[model samples]
Target: MQDTLSNKALLKATVIAVFIAGLALVSFILPAEYNIDPTGIGAKLGLTALANPKAAVVSGAETKATIDVPKSVQAADIIEVIIPAGRGLEFKFAMEKFKKMEYQWQTDGAAIFFDLHGEPEGDTTGYYESYAIATLADMQGSFTTPFAGVHGWYWKNKSAQAVVITLTVSGEYSVIGLKK
Candidate 1:
């Protein structure tokens, strides 16, 4: 009879331990490491940002600007910009409907968080669409505008040191300008 009671107690303890471990995995480990927050606790605790590769750590005001290009002009522009540590900058070009552009950008051996996005022309609601969010040292791609709008990249230098970015563009964009 004593043996039966001891066995029951052992089984109960084992089940409880397993349940607790599962709970920990679901609530903390998965969310903190992989951004899988089924319970939403990770976002409340700000752990999801850590898991996001494109989340920028900005420490100051960001600047933005637009450059106008003649519609009939054809050229290639290479722009270089420097971002201080913990600061961010935005560079964009005005594009017309169905316009296409090829672009390549690289950082000075430092990984930076970036958002590739577009805003429709005369959008007063401050609405924008995000095409990609990435943490990378370099990127190369071609974009075809779905509508008349401004398409560009927002890059943030999250490291402890300043970083220089070089952007090369070819194709149908009218104007290319930087914001701060």
Candidate 2:
């Protein structure tokens, strides 16, 4: 009968849809989104770069970026900050265009979300350029200022315990401490 044929066709369509979804998950979604390609097809097809797209970024592990130590670091300042549990904080520096800074920061064994960014001086549009954003415990690198502004980091602690952040930096800029 026509009714039976329609039912059978619907079942076949459902099965085909499910199969395609599963295959896409294994082939594209897992590799492109999470960088976990169990079948190695993602790597072969160059889908792994879709994971973070940020250079020297770490999601859940420590990835250290080595930067050349500049002579300006002779006046480097090491600041220790304690971020309360389940809170966030911002620390920054005032620098001119084309200036450079070498820095490193680390948390007390807990991973946290961090956004390294810069906001141009006297901008009221809430415009900020993020250099990197990642969830990790430690990172180190040298950064050259792109434009005159306040450049620094905003770290958010998501754990129940307080996190102590020790940051050391040397640069051609003034420190605009935590409450700036």
Model 2 C-alpha lDDT per residue in residues 14-109, reported as the tens digit of each score:
999999999999999998999899989987786875673322212222222222222222345666666678878777778889999888999889
Off by over 4 Å in 2: 1-74
Give one digit per residue, the lDDT tens place, for model 1 in 71-142: 333445566667789888887788888888888889889999999999999999989999889999999998
Q: Estimate each model's TM-score.
A: 0.60, 0.59
lDDT value, residue 149 of candidate 1:
89
- The lDDT, on a scale of 0 to 1, for candidate 2 is 0.76
Overall lDDT per candidate, in order of appearance = 0.75, 0.76
| Candidate 1 weakest ten by summed lDDT | 53-62
Clashing pairs in 2: none
How good is model 2 by TM-score? 0.59
Cα error, residue 59 of model 1, in Å, equals 17
